[model samples]
Target: MQVNNDRLTLAVAKAPQIYLAGVIDADAPQRFESMMRSGKIANGSDIYLNASGADLHAGIALGRLFRQGSMVTHLGTQRRQRGAPAKPALCTDACVYAYLGGLYRWAPTGADRIGFPAQMAVDPKASADPDDTSAYLKEMDIDQSALAPLLTAAHADPAWLPADQLIAARIANNGRLPLTATYQVQNGEPYLTLAEVKRGGQHRMSLECRRDGVLFTAYNAVGAEHAKQIVAHGARSFVEVNHAESYPPQQDYATVQDDAVVIARTYPGAQLGSLISATTLGAWVRDRNSMLRYGFEFELGGLDHILRKYYQACWEYAPWQVAKKS
Candidate 1:
């Protein structure tokens, strides 16, 4: 059932993606659940929402259902045809609350928008129970301060949140959440550490300067059995730079600790000298016995600049004439 003013609809698209459009009402969550139970919505599907407003309570409920299903949320409407592109969409008012429910929420880009209506426009029931809204935000893992702009906007204007601000405030997690990188001094040596946790798993990669070369350490969370199999059967692991395999002649080995598989490899400075200008870095592991291969690739982008700073810091700390950095 849908409200008279706006008819909410759910449209299943290709595998791992679905479209949810129109206004939300008390029955919206029920409609979504019915589709989910009917196997129309696959696990961890990317749900594109084009909702304008909602019953505040119903939107909160729908958001909870999204989190429970481990879904990814984006801002887009259903395509016009089977293979047509999705139309950009806006999520405003109570609809914004529902978007927050996604485990991995993508920020609205370009013409897409996420906005909060002027105070006078908000539903009376929603404004009356500010506590409910506060509680919903907290439950969604959003900090109260993230909604400060929404709260302080002029009474006559809607508060529009940009893509960058949504990400910076942690209100919207672009793709699979932001990657965090930091520099830390360990054992009197400087190291560049980066980590990101998302739906698939956790990944931690670090770079440190060594006398002979740059040590790259990658620790990824894998199942206990898989980790054992990798260590016992001996897996072939390699590092890729810009889609090209660039490791030294030394074979890479894996160790299992803390339910994670870790590999440490040192690449000569001259070989990795172009790393700062490279486009991507990938860590790959292949089972020696079978065709199973798993890996993760990271785009350099901002990381390249970070690597430059790390190289300079390494030189300042332990100046060596030999080129020995990655």
Candidate 2:
């Protein structure tokens, strides 16, 4: 299911990116979904769009992209003919709705006069379910007042909002997610502050420590103590984080204490069997593998139990069998 008409087209490539141009249509969402499941466009890819808006139901497609956790960026290239004025592309109309789908958005720095149009108000029926729009606004951390003027259905050409307004509404992001964020932990564990936490990773896992609370990470620093608690008994259902690549730049492994589905990940993450020696586990966790093929997946546990044991057997330079947790 592909559409390559002059009005709208979707070009996907191995950079794992999508390029959208022209007007969006109702059926675009279905086609995009097919592309995602078929692995033509992997989930979490970034989107670069050049659209002045959409014909109809484009918001639905944009919302689906947003929920897929794909980042969105407005694309443009301005070249003035000698003595001519500059005309930058505006993500107006339903295009604004789609652009808002980016989890971490970006636009040319200092670029101005970009936003939705008065025509958005042309269809009162489009506002039929303010709840849906309201929900999206909340997720994007955008203000309701911001959308009122931008999405108004008046017949005039709308004045685009400036960067300050967009920044205040958090529509223009520079990659990092606000640590002032909040989320509910389903397992009744206390949520940890995300302050100073890095914001980008595909296979990040969410784990709960007996004393350390919840840690959602895709890197090596979930804390040495957190790793220890993971391999300890009773950690049956923790969430697992992966880098999505078999040989990601950074990695960690571990098994949950039990099996109510601990270490939940979108893909079957790597594991480090308990049968392996703690020394070998330590090398992997410490990233001492001499021939590690970048992007290849291995069976290391969610917390790298071997590293935890290695830390146990050698923490603080204590003697073997006399070290902490040994």
Candidate 3:
């Protein structure tokens, strides 16, 4: 266990788990890079962020390093006594920006804290540039709203973000991006696809509206192996909506297509209404012995509006128009 108690201290008492502490000044980045060059810390290491504040530019630089290394950041400090119980740690000012760099970020828990301070007040010689920080946050897929508290904070203190807000805006995402639904056209036919990327892999599903009904297809990259196993032996597949069984299980319903495992089915057009009104959707594969072989769920964010557009493009019909006609 090595410890450095300088302006910024970086230690790797536990392999692949680097512990960081102290204040971050302009030289923080260079010191961090030196720690990196020591080969003690590996890529994708867990970075325990125990620092309080940082120089604006210096924090951004450290953030870029965190992203490049695909690190995970948590708010906590190292224990002087080995195996000691967890203690509270605060990451404030530009340190908040550094925390956002983690590929997989854990929200501040219990007494652990993260906040944004008035940059100039925190460091009189700080080269604080809101534009640069804004761009960096955008690149991290953080909502612009996360920046508002920083720019508008009281000069005497730091603005702390609640854990819920951090998770909602994805500032403390557990290695996942927000799911999105998009309207796309192929061969003059419009369809809707909902997709998301996470540490596990990508999950996508498409809905095609037809005169008879709607065709639903789930493409699961993570389930590719399970799909192949099904083709070789056999298994039952089903779709789930809001944690309830939405489709009947059938043998050999999964098929491998290129890199993903796909399951396609058709349902009554009114089913589209149920889906549009639902909050979550998922697909599953079950073994003959009744075990859950594999599955994944998707949050139906912004899908209702896109599905409405798909209905109009498919059959020149919108639910509101039909409601008005009646």
Q: What would the per-residue lDDT of candidate 1 be over residues 63-158, giving only the tens digit for each residue?
A: 888889988888877566979876778887668878988988998876887776554223233444533776677678887664665546534345
Model 1 clash pairs?
Answer: 269-325
Question: What is the TM-score of candidate 3?
Answer: 0.72
Q: Candidate 2 regions off by >4 Å?
A: 1-15, 54-56, 77-88, 110-113, 118-132, 146-156, 181-198, 201-326
Candidate 1 residue runs with Cα over 4 Å from true position:
1-93, 106-175, 233-235, 321-326
Candidate 3, residues 72-126, lDDT tens digits: the string is: 7888877778688778888987677788788889888889888765542222232
Best by TM-score: 3
Q: Which one wins by lDDT: 2 or 3?
A: 3
By summed lDDT, the worst window of 10 consecutive residues in model 3 runs over 317-326
User: How many residue pairs clash in all the candidates, one count each?
Assistant: 1, 32, 0
Compared with the true structure, the alpha-carbon lDDT of candidate 2 equals 0.44
Q: Estimate each model's TM-score.
A: 0.56, 0.45, 0.72
The true-versus-predicted C-alpha distance at residue 226 of model 2, in Å, is 20
- Model 1 vs. true fold: TM: 0.56
Over 4 Å off, model 3: 1-15, 34-43, 77-86, 118-132, 146-156, 159-162, 210-212, 223-235, 248-252, 255-261, 287-293, 303-305, 317-326
lDDT of each: 0.71, 0.44, 0.70
